[model samples]
Target: MLFKLLLLGLVIWGVYHFFIKQKPIEHKDKEADVMVECDKCGTYVSNKEAIIKDGKYYCSKKCAGVEQ
Candidate 1:
């Protein structure tokens, strides 16, 4: 009986690990993206997130001197 119980428990654990359990998540590396310095604040921001104005990079619209 103990052997059967152990086998059932093993089967359940296997099923949970193989099907019911969540997969390991993969994260993006910030270091892999290009970083740019903001012209006004000199803050370093991702190239994708930085705002471009007059051939310079800015961290935000306010730094770029945009009214809106």
Candidate 2:
């Protein structure tokens, strides 16, 4: 009985490992994530998260001197 249970478990595991297809992870683009230097304080940050004003890059809106 124990041998049969082990064999059953092994068969299930093999089927799951061989038959399942994993989806590939998708990203927007590599260039969008490139590190950019902050113009105000020289801190490095990702291009997508940086604030842009007057053709300059800033780590935050505070550094860019833009206020709400």
Candidate 3:
């Protein structure tokens, strides 16, 4: 018909702009991990999973006494 409905609306807008309107680019490979509080229970954690002792920063290793 009208050139097969303009080639089926340009193949449904090129399959909705190459597969359903594209929107998936979350690549964050490291840049939001520096929390670290827990000096024995103030408890914040995530300086790459806390626990460094003496200079403080524990979120476990049983609050950094380090028995396990």
lDDT-best of 2 and 3: 2
The TM-score leader among the candidates is 2
Could you tell me every candidate's TM-score relative to the true structure? 0.51, 0.53, 0.27
Give the C-alpha lDDT of model 2: 0.85
- Tell me the spans in candidate 2 whose CA falls farther than 4 Å from its real position: 1-32
Q: Write the per-residue lDDT of candidate 3 for residues 1-68, one digit (tens) a residue.
A: 99999999999999887754443422232465889788877989898899787888888898788986
TM-score ranking of the models: 2, 1, 3
By lDDT, the better pick of 1 and 2 is 1
TM-score, candidate number 2: 0.53
What 10-residue stretch in candidate 2 is worst by lDDT? Answer: 22-31
Q: In candidate 1, how many Å is residue 28 off?
A: 12
User: Candidate 1 residues 1-68, lDDT tens each?
Assistant: 99999999999999898764444422235445689999998999999999999999999999999889
Greater-TM-score candidate between 1 and 3: 1
Put down candidate 2 lDDT per residue, 6-42, tens digits, no spaces.
9999999988866553322233354348899999899
